[model samples]
Target: MGVHHHKIGGGKLLIAIVLNLILTVVQIVGGIISGSLALLSDALHNFSDVSALTISHVAHTLSSKKATVKETFGYKRAEIIAALFNASVLIAIGIYLIYESFVRFYDPQPVVSVWVVGLGMLGVIVNGGSIWLLEAEAKGNMNIRAAYLHLLGDTLTSVAVVAGGAAMYFWHIYWIDPLISIAIALYLIYASLSLVKESTGVLMEFVPEDLDVEEIAEAVAREPDIKNIHHLHIWRINDREVFLQAHLDFEQNLSLQEVTRRIEKIEKMLKHRFGISHAVLQPEFMRDDEKDLIKGES
Candidate 1:
């Protein structure tokens, strides 16, 4: 079932890539003819989407590979790395657009509204279609979400360019072109920064943002011998996998078999409650150690 789902996702991404490539070519030609900064910015945005989607498709493939002794974690983190790289490039593109928009704003060149409006409509349709294709996969997958957000931003900016183009056509408002480009640039930067931060967090092994240590402690307490759970650590292996480790202070020394049973229960609870795929728990009997739930930064 999982493999089938991944295959569907990869196929959809390829379709999106092709659509964006076509839109990029059309918009580049339209922007040149129209001398519209907004159309050009949208073209640049679509170009980034092509690159981002390609990276996501590759990473998605790598993440499906089986684990081995040489790489116990497999390639689960490939998606996160791809997301970080894609988002960083998006930000760079946004920054470039802002600079270009300002220069165009000051110069205030005449724009050909007919080409701008026609191709701007095409941009909206193409980007919107790609956004829909990736929407379901984006829900739980950060790498795919990065690509989806790019398409989302593209569709919105294309709408703005179309509106600006109409105004230019009806009222000869050339300044609206660069103004819309600036808005498009700002939106891309704003949308991409959060994705970049999230990808960075996973790669840095920061604690999973939504994890609750107290909930884990409660699970540990299910075993009567466990006095407390401390020295806790929780981090992500990927979007779908989390890892946890902690010390469980016992009321007294227990049999090895009994300890195994208790730990198994705790592991099950953690898995169901927090989606933790793996855990390491050390059992201790009044051992000398820092008994805090957390030691420091982990």
Candidate 2:
């Protein structure tokens, strides 16, 4: 099967980017006119969404290109790279927002609540639509997940702005508007940093958190024709592919056909049981080599 099976393409992402661009501009104007920090922060989040979605769209398109000798993995990793960049950008923006919130608190101002509520409502609608478009693809792909989380978080932030603006309009609680912006910043920091760690793990070729090496060794050792499995390495090439390679010491000298058959059987078992998408085995009769489960990173 293809790497991008069931994944969305660039066209939907383009639409999302366009929607966010428009929302960002409108919210910025409204924020400036109303002197509302909440509106300005919402506009900032929308702008980040536009940047993230644009990166996601480019990566999504590149990932579909056919692999070649110069790029054997094709562009499958483009999504992971995009995700890392977007997440880092988000964290920086979050920190900046926090600093701005402090400044706003230090110098309080009267905000026009009507514009805050109105632009906030617009934020909800635009981000909601973007979320709808990208929701399905986010589960399996980290790149899209980063962008989706931006939309998801911003949608909630917009809701908070509307609530805070309502308080300011009716109860003279203008101080709460900066607090709303702070809340948005805190959430952005939390979500984006987590994604940054995940993307880093994938890029470092760390063993997937879900799979254990000893369990795999035990399963392979259980094979009647196999003596032991050693020097095992398991890592994900991207979000969707997990690759494993090991040296399998056989019980005795066996025919080439028999060895191939046993290898195929082990491959199938790994796929069915562990969701390992790719497996490579080196058959050995009595070769003197490392017997440890993990020698070092390959």
> Per-residue lDDT tens digits of candidate 2, residues 153-241?
89998999999999999997888988888888899899888889888998998889989888989999999889989888898878889
lDDT of 1 by residue, 156-176 (tens): 989999999999999998988
Quote model 1's TM-score. Answer: 0.95
In lDDT terms, how accurate is model 2? 0.90
> Which residue pairs in candidate 1 collide?
none
Candidate 1 — worst ten consecutive residues by lDDT sum?
215-224
Q: Which stretches of candidate 1 lie over 4 Å from their true place?
A: 296-298
- Predictions in order: lDDT: 0.89, 0.90
